[model samples]
Target: MREKAQESVKAVLPVMVIVLILSFLIAPLSPDIMVEFMTGAVLVIIGMAFFSLGAEVSMTPMGERVGGNLVKTKKLWFIIGTGFVLGMMITISEPDLQVLARQVPSVPNMVLILSVALGVGLFLAIALIRILVGFALAPLLILFYLLIFLLAMLAPADFLAVAFDSGGVTTGPMTVPFIMALGVGISAIRNDRHAEDDSFGLVALCSIGPILAVLILSLVYQTEGSFSPEIGRNIATSVEVGQLFFEATPDYMKEIAVSLLPITVFFGLFQMFSLKLEKKTLSKILIGLVYTYIGLVLFLTGANVGFIPAGNALGTVLAALPYSWILIPLGMLIGYFIVKAEPAVYVLMKQVEELTDGAISGKAMQISLSIGVAVSVGLSMIRVLTGISVLWFLIPGYVIALGLTFLVPKIFTAIAFDSGGVASGPMTATFLLPLAQGACIAMGGDVVRDAFGVVAMVAMTPLITIQILGVLYVRRETQSADRSTGVEYQVDISELFAEYEDDEIIEF
Candidate 1:
């Protein structure tokens, strides 16, 4: 319990400080606004504690256990079918996906949501199959990404930007911890010693499935719209922060409850028939679910109320300045700090460092993620400043990443992909996106074309940064090999005789 509190403080306290600093920088906050922001910050801290506790209690363990049990099936198709259905269902429940769906113009919300979910479902199934079959991660990535890029070339021009962004936002906080835990669980089922190494990348590859699926959807819709950036989101003054929380509270709580319902029902049915979970265990998990629900509500409310408006206001004020080029460096600074505050990232980086026995340290991973997200933020702000095609950056970026897939270590290939999804946390959507949107508005650009892909850019750079780490590791290995080759192998017979004489060798 103390641990969870410390974690929450470490995560939420920094953001609260950032908020206070921003409030001061803006027009001197009225007294009411000051109190409201403070209250919202408190709520956010409370929410992070609940959400983190709930995830540990319910989400991660449940997914891991279920994943282990589900993949025990001898029948391959059954596992695939389960993966497909679960992926689709989870995406349908993802708040971030719903948020992205609403922003997609002309497409019916349900239709687009369903399509994106289906894309996730189909790819998730394939990802599971890859794990089970024990395919090399590198080659598989090359093949699938090659197809994705090829499809992008032929895909509708208007839909290109949207296609890539789907890959980013679909794997937000709600989906990452559970899905990554599930991968760990499922991979543990493998008898191979390398199974632990293989467990790291399921979310990574699963993220791709959406990109490919969306590009296909794009083929059906013509999206050749003019490109411009704009941002318009409700900004809360200190007085209005509490009001924002109240307004956002009910919807997120209801949505989160509904999201968990199907999975719980499925677990209940499975337990009744097959697993029969012990009373104590069942009770604990149920309690954890409650924690998750409470946590998500608070987290969402705080993010919408305190985080989003503050970020947008700051971005708008900065972008409107004559020295708007400051947006890039400012974005990099914000990106560096923003990642540390994302709750799920702590879970992931800790797990990786532990699982690898320091082969990959959390500090190193943190540094890589910081650099990646920083570059992404800079790129995103540039898009806000000038309405460049998202493809102009995305295609080249993905190509370089995919190219690195072949050159880097297998584990890194997986980690890189997962990092993309992991990087697009709640902060990205609730705060950073709004910031870009606000900047776009300040610049009078089209919001959908320009601001929409910030999440995509956030998701892209990690794929490269982590892979570069992998490349470095491989180079060190090569250097070590070459150095070892220079050493001569010789028998020190006289020294052996002297050592043997002193030891009085027993075996002889």
Candidate 2:
């Protein structure tokens, strides 16, 4: 518990420091807002710690068991149906997606939420099918993405960014651990060469479903509505600050409970019918569930109430300056550190290290994600300032990302795509999205078109950067093998990569 708390502090502290520096020196926030931000930061740290421990203890094991048991049945229809049901339940519980649904005024909250949930459910079924059949991930990704773009061409301009943002937000802290573990659990049953590679890409594919669903919905239900920004309230007293959080606490507690209920219920059912695990293990998971509930409540309250308002105020203040171009670099600086703050990132990094036997270091993945997010935020700020269409960047960005899948190790492609979604977790939704929205408002730009896709950009860049890391990893390994063997190696690139993959997995 103490170690988890320490890890949470490290993950969250950098963003706090950056915000403080900006608040104090660059764009001063009101005293009450500062107190709120500080108080929220404390809750965020504590919440993340508890959430991390709980996810590891509860969600990961539950998902793996369910996935493993489902595969053992060897019934394709059963797997598909269960996968879809589980996907919808988990996605509907995702707090970040809920936040987004509230902000998009044109669509009814239930309609949008259900649509995104359905998208996730369907793709999750497809992901499981791919793993079961050992189908390649890249071609499927290309085909779906092409379809997404075709739909995008018909999607209303106002809906374009929100549609893409849907993809990123759906794979938040609540969803990533379970979905990734499901992939691991399913792939564990496979003794094939590509099982590890296939263990990823579930999150990647699940991320896409939300985008396509939202885009298609936009086409069918086009309506005129402006982006709704969170209104920052004025608080003069310390008592009000306390009252502010006190008032918000129950709402989040309820939200988190509702968010966690489906997964908890499903796990309970699985335990009854399938797992039949020993009492001690069940007790541990039950306790973990309690911790997860507490952590998420605190985390959501702190982020939505404390961090978001501050982010908006800062973005508005900074962008209104004479030389607002500073926002590009400033946003980049913040983005670099902010990705570290995402709760799901730790889970992804830890799993990657464990699965790869440290061949791809967590530190390397962290650095690559930071760089990718930094670049993405910079581009997003430029869009906020200049009002460039999101498609101009997204189309080319994905093309590059998808194109690299053929060049790099298959595992890297999977991990990279997963990183895209994981990288754009709660912090991006609550802080960065508000920041972009605030900036867009101040710049007299269309908030939906200009500010909304910050999450998408954050989600896109890691696909390329991490794969570039994979390419470099491949080149270095090739050189090392040549040096060790004292002979130049000439062979098909895929063949060489396969040799490395087998050797790396064996070294574990």
Candidate 3:
């Protein structure tokens, strides 16, 4: 417990410091803005920590055990069907989809929500097959991405960013842990050394499904009745922590709980068929469920109360200022720290490092994420400045990244794309969206079209950077090969023995 708490603190500290610096040294915010953001940051911390605890308690064990059980079967349809259902069910429970759905201007929230969920479910099935067939991750990625680029060229320009953004938002705090563990458990049952290599690519592939689905959605959204969102209102009450907690806490808790129920229902179905969970295992998971519940509730309350509004207000103030160029640099600084705050990132980085025994360091992944996010933000600000179609950037960018997939190490290509989705989690939704929204309002631009693509950009860049790192690693390895063999020849044992052999006994 103490160790977990320390981990949570380490994760939260980066965000806390960023927030503090932004509030004081940057555009000084109103007291209300400060209060609201602090509250929101607190909620994010609690949400992440508790959500993590809960996954350990319930989601991981259940997903692993269920996956392991199912994989033992020889029936092919059973594996695909189970994975599909599980993916769809988990994606529905994700709060990030809801958050993005609210931003979308066309179609009912439920329509977009269900659409994205279905897409994830379908692709997860495909990913499982890829793993089972021992397929090359590179060629499939290349082929599918070529199709995506073709679709992008034919599709409406507006659909481009939204499509890519759908992929990232689906892989939020709620969806990541369970889905990853399920992939691992299922892969582990195969008894192949390559299982570890195959344990990944689930995230990378699942991300693409949504982009394609939402591209279809964009067509529907173009014709369907427009859905306008009224920004959520907080009644002007005396701002007290106690009062805010009582009112907003229940609301967000209910929202998160409702979203989470489908996963439990799925779990219940698994339980009905003799899941074979030890009693102690079940008890611990139940405890984790409780912790997750409390943590998410607090997390939502704080973020909504403090962070979202403060973020918006900060953007508003910064954009209105004479030195609005500060937006890019300021966003870069925050982006550098922001990805660190994501609890799931730690899980991903640690797992990769451990699997490869530091051949793939978390430090490298972290640096890549930070640099990618910074660049994405700079580009997003440019989008707001000029009303360019999202395609102008996203289409070519993905083409380059997918093109690199064929050239880089297989794992590097997979992990890089997966990180793209994982990096654009709740903080982007709550804080960065508000930041961009605030700036848009200041710039007199269409907030829906201009400000919204920051998350998309944030998600897109990591695919390129991480893959580039992979290319570097590959080059370095190639260059080192000749020198390594030369060293081997120079150090031959025949020369070493000259000093110590029988003749040497007399000469020495």
Candidate 4:
């Protein structure tokens, strides 16, 4: 547990150092805000460690067990029905979704939230069916994205970026652990060689559901409002920073309790009806749940109270500088490290390492993800500076990613798409989004049109970069096979066949 906590600190420390350096060199902040940011960073590091450990012990096991049990019954309707219910239940409670819903001005919070949840539920069912039936991921991706774009055409201009961003934010820290584990559990039942490949793409499919659903909803309900920038409150004294965290604690506790209830109840009922696990295992899960609850509360509180204001302030200050163009490279640099701080990235990377038996190391996955996110943040900064449409980048970016899908291994395609959502977890929503919004505001750009797609961009880039890694992996394997064949050719044919002389000998 202590080691996990240290790992979280290491992941987050680089970003913290970058922020401090910026504060000192260029984007100096108010003493109060700096104090708050420092305090929040501490809480986030601690919270992330606890959350990661809890997800390993509790969420992963529960999801896997439930998924495994559901498939054992072999009832198609039951599987789809359970998938839908579970998807909706888990999504409705997602902290990142809640944060996103609050920010979108056009749609009513409940309307958007329910729309996103329903989308996830439906797509999750589709993903389950695809796995069971052995459908190809590439074609389904092309088809659904085409549908999303068609709906995007009908959606209000103001809602277009928000619609796509919904997909990225919905599959956040809480959702990824459960959904990824569920895929593992379901695919475990399969005896096919592609079962490992099938364990991925569930998150990828679930991500698309919210985008399509929200875009359709946008067309049906056209409401016009603007995102109101959060006004910074005056802090008279440094002590007030501690007071701020204290006051925010109960609110997050209540929110997390509400968010966790449906999933908890659902899991309990499932266990009673089907799981029937041993007492010791159940006790461990319960304890882990406690850890998850506490960790999430602290994590969200730090992010919302500490990071958001600091990010906004920093962006505003930097963009107002004489050499405002620095924002682009600065954004890219921040992007490289910010993804490391995301809790879900750790989960996905560890899962990939384990699934591939270390053939794909977690370190390699992190480097690929960081590069992808760096490009994304650079593009996002360009959007902020110039007020360009997100479509310009997204269209070609996804086109290239989908094209690579055919060229890479099936498992890489699945894992690449999954990494999109994992990369845009809570840290992106809480810190990067606000930074973009702040810069957009400074540049007099439309916050919705310009700043909102940062999450979507963050989500899109990994699809291409990871698949690039896939292309290299395939080449390496081919070369290894060739070298083995060459070594075989060097052996004496007479000697090779000598051992089999007593039996029926075969010649090439």
- Tens-digit lDDT string for candidate 3 (183-228): 7778787777777777778888898888888777776567322223
Clashing pairs in 3: 36-306, 36-307, 37-306, 37-307, 39-302, 40-302, 40-303, 43-299, 57-285
Report the lDDT of model 3 for residue 10: 73
Error of 3 at 206 (Å): 1.4
**Range of the 10 consecutive residues with the lowest summed lDDT in candidate 2:** 486-495
Model 2 regions more than 4 Å off: 487-508
Each model's RMSD to truth, in Å? 4.5, 7.1, 3.2, 3.9
Cα lDDT for residue 379, candidate 4? 97
lDDT of 1 by residue, 159-200 (tens): 676777788778866667778888887898898976886887
The deviation in Å at residue 62 for candidate 2 is: 0.8
- Regions of model 1 farther than 4 Å from truth: 18-39, 155-158, 223-243, 474-508
**Best candidate, TM-score:** 4
TM-score of each: 0.88, 0.94, 0.90, 0.95
Cα lDDT tens digits, model 4, 1-508, are 8988988888889988999999999998888778888888999998998899988999889888988988999999999999998899888888777767766666688988888899999999999998888888989999998888777767787777887898898897877898999999999999999998889999999999889877887777776537776545678787787789999999999988887787778789889998998999999999888888888888888888989888888888888989989999999999999999998888899899999999988998899999999999999999999988888888889999999998999999999999999998878887898899888888888888989999999999999999999999999999999999887887866677776755568443
Q: What is the lDDT of residue 370 in candidate 2?
A: 97
Regarding lDDT, does 3 or 4 come out ahead?
4
C-alpha RMSD in Å of predicted model 3 compared with the true structure: 3.2
